[model samples]
Target: MSLSKANKSAYFAWLKHPGHYLFFKIFIWFWLTIIGTVAALVFLSNITAINAVSNEPLYGPMKKNLIYTAKSIERSAVKHKRTLSEVLVHPRLSKRKLLYLSAAQSDDSLSNKEVPESIDLSLLNFTQNMSPQIIFTEKYQAFGPVNIKVPEGSFYLYEIDINHQPPLIMRFKLMPNWMKIVIAIVASLILSFVFSRNLIAPINSLKKAAIKLSAGNLSARADISVNRKDELGILGRDFNSMANQLELLISSQKRLLADISHELRSPLTRLKMATGLAQMQANDASQSYLLRIEKEANQLDKMIADVLQVSRLEAKSQALSLQKQSLQIIVDHVINDAQFEAKQNNKQLNIVGAVDVNINCDESLIASALENLLRNAIKYANNTISITLKHADAIYIEICDDGSGVPNEQLGKLCEPFFRQSDARDRVSGGTGLGLAIAKNAITAHGGSLVLSNKEQGGLCANITLPLIKE
Candidate 1:
C-alpha cells in the first residue's frame, strides 16, 4: 500500500480501538505540562546565569583582596627571612579566611604541591603577561601569578576562591541553554508518554467494562486492572464485586417473578374452568356476575403474562431471532387491528405518510410493540389517531392521538411498569400498566427506541425509531 493509505489505515484502526483516544489526550496534556515546566526552568536558569556572569564581583574588590593577601604573605616571608614557598605555609597566612594560596616558579611552572588538582594548570598562562589576571572554571576562580621576589628565588603567587554557585547550576551553565531545553523536552515527552499510558490503561479497561455492564453484559470485568496491586486494582475489584451483586440480585428477582407467574397460571386456569361450569348452571340474573368474573379473570391472566414477559426480558432469557422484514408491512398489520378497535369506539385511525424500509429486528417483538402503542393511542384519542412513517438514518414510526396529553412531569414515568397517571384513569382504562413498559423493553432489545412526548397541538405522540438494514 501507499504510505498515505497505510497511514490512513492506522489512523482508522486507532479510532476503532478503545481507550487509544483517551490515552493520546492524556499523553499530550502531560507531555505539554512537563515540557513547559522544563522549558521555564531552563529559561530561568539562563537568566540567573546571565545575571551572575554580568554582575560578577571578581573584577573589583576581589581582585584587590587577592593582591593584598599576596603582599602580606610576601612581607611576612621577607621579615622572617624565610623562603616564599616556606612563608606561604605559615599558619596565620595559610588559614586566612576565603583565601587559597598556591606558589609556582617565576616561569609559571609548579614549584611545589600547593596547587590543587581541580585547578587547571593551563590557567597559569595568564600569569606570563606579568599582570594579575582572573581565570574562571566550573568550580572556582583563580587570580594570580603575582610576582613575589625572595633571596632564595623568584616565585608566582596565586589566589583561588570558590565560586559558591551550586554544582548543578554551574554544570548546566557549561552547555548552551537552548540545547539543554531541547534535551529536557525530549526526555520529558518520553517519560510523560510512558507514565500517561500506564495510568490510562487501567482506566480504559474499567471504562470498557462499565460500557458492557450498562449494555446488559453482566460478565464484563476489568481483568487487566484486577491484576495490578495499586489503588486502581482495588477500585477494579470493588467494581467487579458490585457488578456481581447486581447480577445476583436481578437474577433472583427475575426468577421469583417468573416462578410466581407460573404458579398463578394453574389456579387461574382452574378458576376459569369453574366459572365456565357456573355460567352453564346459573339462571339469567346470575349470568351477568359470572361473565364479569370471567372478564376479570382474563385481565388477571394477561397481567400475569405481562409480568412473566418482563422477567424474561430483564433476564435476557429470550434471544432475538433477527430477520430482514419490511417495517411498513409490520406497521400496516398493527394499524389494521388497531383500526377495527378504534371503529368500535367511534374513533378514526389514519396513516399520514408512507415509507418502504427494511429493518433487521425480531419481527414479533416489533409488531407487538407497535400493537401496544397503537392500541394505547386508540384508547386515549378523543376522535382521531394518526400514524406517520418516515425514512431517515433510521426508520421512524410515530403514532399520535388527539386526546388530552400527559402532564409534563409525569411523561418520563409513562414507560415504567405499574405506573399510572391517576387512580381515576387507571380505573377507567382497566389497564395492567405494563403495556408501555413491555413495548419499551421489546424495542430496546432490537436496538430501537420508543419515545413518548406531548404533541404541540394536543395529546401524546409515541415515536419509535428502528435501525434500517443496510443492503
Candidate 2:
C-alpha cells in the first residue's frame, strides 16, 4: 500500500526517536516470540500424538486380518503365481481397511520404497515407521513389533516374496488429523499477556522521561529500573549523570559570562575618564583627534554595557515587570523613532498594520528589543522598511527590509554574540555585532523567541513571537 507524506514522515519519526523505536522493537519482538513459541508447541504435540496413535497396538484388528490373508495367499501362490496379483486387487479384509498394495517383492521392498515427501518429512517418517506386522514369531519378528499407531487413513503394504512362492501382503494405517493440538496451544498462549505488560511498563516510563527531557525539561530522570542490577539500571544511572553534567556546564558558562562582564566595567570607566582628561588640553586640529578618541571610547562603553545586559538576561539577573500595555502605542513610538533615523539614511520606514490589543509584557525590555530590530532593518534596508504586529494565541511582531538578505549559511549565526555577516560592513557601520544577540536574549528572557529568516521575495525578515498573557 502507498502511504501519504504525513504517514511516511510519522513512520520515519518513530524510527528516529530512541524511545519510540525501542517501544516498537519490543512490541514486535514479544508478539513474534509468542507466536513462534506457540507454533512450535503445536507442531511438537502433533508429532507426539501422531506417533502415539500410529503405534502397532492400535492396529490389532488390521494386523490379524492381514496375517491370515497373507498366509492363505502364500499357500495358494505356490500353486499359481497369478494368484498373488489377483488377491492384491481384492484383499480379504475389514470394510474399514484402506491400504496401498506394494507391487515390489518383499525381499527388495524396503530398499526400493522411498518415503513420501511432505512439509514435515521428519514427523511423517516417524509415523510411517510404525506399520503393523503380517505375522509374528519369537524367532522371526513380523514387520518389526513397534508401539506407535499410524493415523486413521494412511496405510503402507508389506510384501513377502520367497523363491518359487507367491507374495504375502499386509497393510497398516498412518495419521490424517492435527487440529486439536493447534487449538490447545493457542489457548495456552493467551495467558502470556500479563507477562508482556510487565515487560513494557518500565520501558514506557523511560520513554516518557526521554520525551520530557527532549522538550527542555532537563530535570526529567529515568527513575524506573534504577534499583535493579541489570543493564536497564546501568542505562538509567548513565542518563541521569549526563543530564546533571549538561545542566551544570550550561549554568557555569552563564555565570562566568556574568562575572566577566561585571569585572570589565571598572577598567572601561577609567579608560573613558583618561580620554576625557587628554581632550581638555588639545589644540583645534588635535581636538578633532581627541573627539574621535572620545567617540570611539563612548562606543566601546556602549558595547560593553550591551554585552553586560545580554549576560544578565541569559543569567536571569533581571526579573520581568509584566503589565498590560497598548501594543499600538509601543509600535508607533518605535516606528516614529526608526523613521527619523531611516530618513537620515535615505530610507523610507512605514507601518503596515495598527494593533490595538493589550498584551502583558516587560514594556522597557520589549521596547528596547523592538528598537534594536528596527535599527537593524534600517541599517540593511535598500530603500524601504515596514513593521507589522498581530495577536492570536501569541503576539507577533515582524520587522522587514527590502535590502539583500543575509547568506543562507550565516542566517543561523545571526543571534550569536559578535557574529557579523560581513566584517568590513559591520566595522564601517560602527556595529559591535551584539544588537541581534542582545535582542534575542531579551526576548528569550521573556519566554519568547526572536526568529531571523530570509524573505521569500527579498531582504531579511525578523519575527518576534511572545505568548499572550492569560487574564
Candidate 3:
C-alpha cells in the first residue's frame, strides 16, 4: 500500500514539474546510449575474434579416420583417410548410408555403431571458419558454444548410419547469458547516474532559490553554479536580476506611502482644530451647517487614523504589550462601558456565552476592538444586541444584532478602511466607515481575524477569533 501511494505521488509530481520530466528523460537517454555503444563494441569484438580463429587452416588432408571394410569392388580395402571427400567416397558401407551408396555398398553402411569419442569432419564446414560471435551452445538444443572447448581442433557433433563407427560428440566454451545482462546494466547505471548528476546540479540550485524567494525573501538569488555555455546558466543569471528589480520596486513603494502619511499629519490636525472652533463661533442659523462641516472634519480625522494604523501594522512598527488575562473579565468591562449607550437607543446589551478563558493579548488593543464592534452592533441593532463568547480552538466573540443586517453582498467590503455601501440609506448611519475596518486591523495586528456574516434569521454577525492561553 505504501509503495503504491508513493508511486502515485511520484507520478503526479513528475506530471506537474516539467524539470523532473526533463531530468528522467536525459537519464534514460544517457543509459541507453552507453548500453548501445558497449554492446556494439563487445559484439563486434566477438565476431572479429571468431573470424580470425575460423580463418586459420585448422584442418589437414588426413586428420583422422575410422572405417571398417566389408564389400569392395574386387575385394580390395578402399583408401582410409580423414579428408572430407575420402570420408564420403570410401569403399564398403563406410558407417554412412550416403557414403555407402557413393562407394562400395554393404549393410554396415545402413546402421551406425558405437565408437570411441570422435568428431565428424564432413558434417562441419571446415573450409571456412565460423565467426566468434556466431552462436555455439549446448549442442543443438541451445544456440551457444559448449563448455568443453577444443582449443586446437575443429569439432562438430553428427548423427550418421554408420554401424562400424561411434556416435560423434563434440563441445566448445561460450559466455553465459546472466553474466552479459549484469555487465550491461551495471555499466549503464554508473555512466548514466554520473552524467545526470552533472547535468542536474544547476537545476537543484534554481529550485532552492525559488523556495527562498517564495518565503518572503525577495532578495533571494541563485548562484551561477553552472559555467557551461548553456541555457540553464543564462536563466539563473536572469532570474537573479529579476528578483533584484522586484525588491527595489517594493521598497520604493513602501517608502512613498510612509512619507506621504507622515507629511499629511500636521495639516490634518490644523484642519480638525479649525473646524471645532468654527462650529463654536457660528450663529444659530449657521450652526447646523457648521456642525455638518465639523462632522466631515471628524470623518477625515478617522480616515487618517486608519491610514496611520495600517501603515504601522504593515511596517511591523507597532509594539505589542501582551499579558495573560481572563477574556471574560475583558468582555465584562467593555460591556459595562457600552451598556449606557445601548439603553439610550432603546437597545438591550447582553453578554451570554462560555467564560473563564484566559488569553495572551495586548489588553488595550483587544478591548478597543471589542468596544468598536459592540458599539457598531448597538448602532445597527433595532433595540437588541447580544455578545457571545464561545470556546473552541480559539475564543470566539460573536456580536449579533436584531437589526436589518448588512446587504448580503457588501459583507466583505465593510472591512475596508473608509469603504461603505454606496446607497444613501447605508451612509445615513453617519460613521466615517472606519469602525469595522479599524477593528479588523487591530484584531489582525493581534494575530486574529474579524469575520462578517449575516445572522441566519435577521442581523449582522461579527465573529472575532482570539487565541486564548489554556488554563
Candidate 4:
C-alpha cells in the first residue's frame, strides 16, 4: 500500500504507543531479569566465600568437627562394646548441634539435647522407625542466617555448670555457589536488553506501515537500516514493491472507469435525441414504435448516468450539494410522482404513518434514489403499495408493494449491475434492470444505505436510511 507522510507518521505513533513498546521492553526486561537473578545468586556466592575463607577458611574447622563427632561416637561404641548410639549418647557438634540417630530399632536411644550447630531443634523431626538409613541431614533457615548441616535426629543436651565451663558455639556457613550463578545470569540479561532492542526495531517499523495502510494511506513503506542485513531488510524491500503495484493498479482502474464513462456519453445522448424526434413525427401505428424507441433511449440514458456516477465514486470525486431537508416531504413528493405510473399499471398507492425528520444530504441525488425505488415497487406491485417514513438515528424511507417478491436465492445478486429478479418480467416492464443498482449507488454516495427485501405483505420493500443532522 502507498500512503502519505501524515498517515505514515500516525501509524508509526500507534506502534510506538507506551503499551505496545512496553511489551517489547518487558520481554527484554523479564529475560534479563532471569539472567540477572541467576547472576545475582552467583555474585552472592563469591562474596560469601571471599568473606568466609579469604583469611583463614574457618568453615573447614566446623565441617571437621561434625565428622569428628560422628567418628568419635563410632570409636566410643567399639570401646564400650555397645552400638555407637549407646557408647557416646550422641556427641554434640555444638552447644545446639543435633545428636540423635535413628537406627534399626537403634542399638540404644542416644539423643543429646544440644541443637545442631546449623539447625533449629523446634523445626526438625526424627523418626527411627521410618527410613532409619537416612542418617544425616542439613538444615538452614531460608531468608535467614545461622545456616548449618548435620546428622539427622542428632543433638547433645547436658546440664552444664556454666560458671565452671565456657559455653561453645559452632558457626558454619555454606560455599556460595548459588550466588555465583546468579551474578552470571544478571550480566547476561543486561546484554540481552541491548540485543532485544536491536531485534525489534525493524518490527516496529513494519507495525507502523501496517497501521498506515489500514488508515487508507496505502503508500506507506518501511525503512530498514538494521546492521544485520538479514530477513528484516528483505521484508522492507518487499513491502515497498507491494505498495508500488497497489498504487499503480488503483490509479489504472480509476482512469479506465472515467474513460469508459466519457466514451458512452456521446452515444447515449444521440440515441435520446433520435428517439425524441421519432416520437414528435409519429402517427397512430407509428406511436407504439416511437414509444419503444423512447423507452429504450431513456433506459440507455439512465445507464450512462449510472456509469458516470460509479466512475466518480471510484475516483473519490463525488461532491454533495447538501442541504437541510425534510425526509418525509421528499418521500411524499416522490410517491406522488410515482403514483401516476402505479395507477397506469392498475395499482393502488397507500401512505402509512408520517415521520417528521430532517437530514443534510444531496437533495437531487436522494430524490433520484427514492424515485427509482418507488418506480421499481410500482412495476411489480399486484394492485396495492405502501410508503412509510420513520424517525430514528437516521431518517428511514420505506416503499413496499404487494407482488410476487424476489426469490429467496436471488437477494444478494439483486444489487449487481444489470441484475433483475425475473429477466422476462424486467424485459416486459421496459426497464434496463439498473433501477435498484442506481438507487444503491446513490444512497452510498449520500453516506447512507438502500436495502431491498421481500415484504411479509406479499411484495418487495425497498428500505432507505440517511443520517439525520445531529444538531
Candidate 5:
C-alpha cells in the first residue's frame, strides 16, 4: 500500500531538518571526540619537546657534562704531553661515563661502536665557538661539538650517550605536522562512521517498528537482538513490550464488543418477533404504536450488526475475500440502488465521472460501504447528490450532497461510532449513527481511508480512497 499524506509529510520534514537526526548528531560527536584527542596529544607532545629543549633537567645537565668531558680531555692531553687521540683511548677517561666523542672535521668517532646505525651524523654541524649543541635521535641524545684546545690543533668534541633515548615528544617529531593531522582526520572519519552506524542501526529498526505499529500492524515488533546490552537495546525491548500490551488490550476490547453485540442481537431478535405478533393481534388505534416499536427494533438490530462488523474489522477476525473486479460494476450497482432511493425521496442522484478502473477488493465490503455513504447522502441531500470517481495514485470515490454542511468542529467526529451532530442531524433523522463508522472501518480494512469534509458551497462530501493493486 502507498504511504498516507501524514507519513509522506513526516518523511519530507525529516529530510528538511537534517540536524534533527540522531545519526548526524552521533557522527559529529564521535568525529569531534577523535579529533580533539589527536589534537590534545599533539599539543602535549609539542609542549614536552619545548620543555626538554629549555628545561634545566635535560639541557642543563647535558651541557655541563659535555663541557666537563672536554676539559678533562684537554687537561689530560696537556698534562700527560700526549695527543688527544691517546687521551680519548685511556680507560680512566673513556670508561668514566657512557659518553662518546666525535670530531667535527674528521670522520673518526666512537659513534659507530656506541650508537645505533640510524643516527645521522650530519645533524651535528659544529662551529669554531666553544659552546656545545644538543641533538636528539630516536635511540640516543648527543650534546656535542665543544672546541677543545690542547697546544696542538683544536679538536671538536662530541659527547654521545647510547643509553639516553629520545622521549615520546621527540619520537613523533619525525613526522611532518600536516601528515599527522591528515592521518588523524582519516582515522577519525572511519571510526566515527563505524561508531554512528553501530549506534543508529538499532534505532532505525525501532523507528520502523513504531511506524508499522502506528499504521495498524499490531504484530509489529523491533528486530533487536538479545545480544545487545546497551541502553538502546533496553529501549527496543521496552518498545516491543508496549506494542505487545497494546495489541493484547485492543484485541480484548474488540472481542468484548463483538460478544456484547452478539448478546444484544439475541434479545433484539426476540423483541422484533414479539412486536410482529403484537401488530398481528392489535386494534387499529394500537397499530401505529406497534409499527413504531417494530421500526425501532429494526434500527436497533442494524446498529448491533454494525457494531459486530466494526469489531470484526478492528480485530481483523475475518480475512478479506479479494478478487480483481471492475470498479464500474460495483459503483453502478450502488448507484442504481441509491438512485431509486433518491427518486423515492424526491432527490436527484447523478454519476459525474467514469468508474472504468479495476481494483482488488472484497466486493461485498466495498459495495456495502458505498451503499452506506450514498444512503447517508440521499437522506441528507436537499435536491441533488453527485458521485464522482477518479483514478490516480489511488482510486477516489467522492459522494457529495447539496444538504446543509455539518458544523466544522463536528466534521472530525462524523465517522465515530454513535456520534451525532447536535443540530438537524440528530437521532430523529432515523439514523443509528453507526453507518459512517461501519463504512470507515470497512474502507480502512481494505488499506484505504474514508475522509468526511464539508463542501464550501454547502453539503457533506464523503471521499473514499483505495490503493490500486499492481498488475
Candidate 6:
C-alpha cells in the first residue's frame, strides 16, 4: 500500500484495538511517575555519591604498604650481610606471598633465580632523579622502587623488585547490569498492561453500547455493573438509566402515533363516502369544487397511511416478513410507473442496468421505498431522470435527476417528516413531504440506508445501499 493508505489503515486499526487508549496512558503514568521516582532514589543513593570519589586510584594504599615492606627487607639484608643467592632463600621471601622482593645482577648466580626474572634488567640504568614505575602484564605485576639500581658497591645490592598477584580492586572490570534492567522493564510492561486493561474495559463497553444505541438499537445498554469504586462505574450506571428512559420515551411516541393514525382512518372513510354522495347530487360547476375536496381527502389519507407505516417500521415489536425476491423486477416496476409520471412533465426516464440480483427483504416495503424516491425525482426533474444499479460488497441503487437540486444546507433535513425545501416544488406538486421520510424509515427497517446528495453535474441523486443476501 501507499504511505498515506497504510497510515490510514493503521490509524483505524488502532482505533478498533481494545487496549490502544490505555496503552499510552499507562505507559506514561508508569514510566514518568513510578519508574522515574524509583530511578531518582537509586541514582542519589548508589551513583551520585560514589561517582564523587570513584575516579581516585584504587592502588594507593597497596603502594604504600609495598614501600614499607621494601624498607624492612633492606634492613634485614644489611644486618645479615648475605649474598644475593642467600637472599633468595631468606625466610622473609618464603613467608610473603603478595610481595616478592629480590636483588640480582646478570653476572651473579642470583640472576638465574626464578624470583629475580620477574624484574626487568633495564631498571638498573635508572638515574637518581627518575621515580620507580609499576608495570602490569597478563601473568604478574612488578613494582621497582626509586633510587634502586641493579648493581651497588661490590655487587648488585639495590636491584630490589616486588612481584605478586594484582590487587582485587585493581582487577575490577566494567560490565552492564542488563539482567536487572530487563527484569525491571518486563515487570513494568506487565503491570502497565494489567492496569490499562482494568481501566479501559468499562469505557470500551460503554462506547460500544453508545454506538449500538445510536444505530437504532434502543435496547443496547452498557450493562456494566462492575464493582469499581471509580467514576467509570457511576458513568455506566447513568448510561443504562439514560438508555432505559430513551427507549421508554420512543416507545410511547410510536404507540401514540400509531393509535392516532388508526383512529383518523374511521373519520377519513366517512368523509370519502360523504364526498362521493355529494358529488352525485352536485351541479357541473360545483363538480370541480367537489373533485378538489375529494383530491385533498385522498392526499390526507395517503399521508396518514405513510405516517402509520413509518411508526410500524420504527416499532421494535414489528418484525419484517423477509423473502427472496428479484431486485431487478422491483426496479423495473418502479421505473415503469415513474416513466408515465415523467412523460406528463416532458421528462425522459432511463434505466442504466440489466443485472438481475436477488435480495432477502420485505418485498412490498422495499418496493414502496423505491417508488417514493422515483416519484419524488419525477416531480423535480427538469428533463432527464436516470436510475443506475451496481453490486459490490452490497447492492447500490442510485436515482438521479437533471434539475436544480435542493440547497446544500437543507439536504439533511429532507428526510425529516413535513420538511420541505424553501422552494415552490412542494406547493406546485401537492406533496405532503412525508414520502421521503417514510421511505427512509422503511429502508432503515431493512438494515439499509438512503442518502441524498447533489451530483457534481448539477442534479440531485438519491442513493440506496442494501446488504446483499448470502447464497
* lDDT per residue as tens, model 6, 1-471: 456987687445645763656646665686556556645544443452221111222257656665665555555557666544465467766455533333333343233235544445443333223344454332345444422222232332223334444444323211123533554567666777677667767887898899999766899999576676689999999999999999999889878878999999999999999999999999999999999999999988988988888777776455788998898888888778887888888899878876388888888888899999988888888889898889888899999998899889888788877788854768888887788987888888888899999988888999999988887
lDDT of 2: 0.64
Give all TM-scores, in the order shown: 0.63, 0.60, 0.50, 0.54, 0.70, 0.65
Taking the tens digit of each residue's C-alpha lDDT, what string does model 4 give over 1-471? 898999788546635665666435665676867776765654554553323321122245544544465556555555555544444453343344335443332242334544344443222232222221211112322110111122322333211111221111112223345544554566666767667666776787887787776543557877676454789888877887888888788778757866886898888788778878877887889989878887767766667777677656545588888888877787778877888888788888888777677778787878888888888888888888888867767777788888889886787677766677777888888776666766787788777877778877678888887777878
Error of 2 at 453 (Å): 1.8
Badly placed stretches (over 4 Å) of model 1 are 1-172, 179-224, 227-232, 319-322, 402-412, 456-458
lDDT of 3 at 361: 82
Ranking the candidates on lDDT from highest down gives 5, 1, 6, 2, 3, 4
Which candidate number has the best TM-score? Answer: 5
**lDDT digits (tens) for residues 1-471 of candidate 2:** 899998688546755764646545665566567767766755554553444232234366645655565555444445454443454444353222322333221211221122333212222233334455333211122332222112111223442211111122111112223444454345545544455446655665677778887754667887766566776777777877888887788778767866787788898789878878878866777888878887877887788788788777766788889888887787788778887899999999767665677877788888889989899888888999978777788888889999899999888789878899999988888787889988898888878998899998899999998877677
Task: Name the best candidate (by lDDT).
Answer: 5
Model 6: lDDT of residue 179 = 38
Better of 5 and 6 by TM-score: 5
Which residue pairs collide in model 2, if any? Answer: 53-149, 54-148, 54-149, 54-150, 55-147, 55-148, 55-149, 151-174, 151-175, 154-174
RMSD of 3: 12.6
For every candidate, C-alpha RMSD to the true structure in Å: 9.9, 13.2, 12.6, 13.9, 6.4, 10.2
lDDT computed for candidate 6:
0.69
Clashing pairs in 5: none
Runs in model 5 lying further than 4 Å from the true structure: 1-15, 19-30, 46-120, 124-173, 190-217, 220-239, 343-350, 378-386, 400-416, 419-424, 451-461
Model 1 C-alpha lDDT versus the unseen true structure: 0.76
What is the number of backbone collisions in each predicted candidate, taken in the order shown? 0, 10, 13, 51, 0, 0
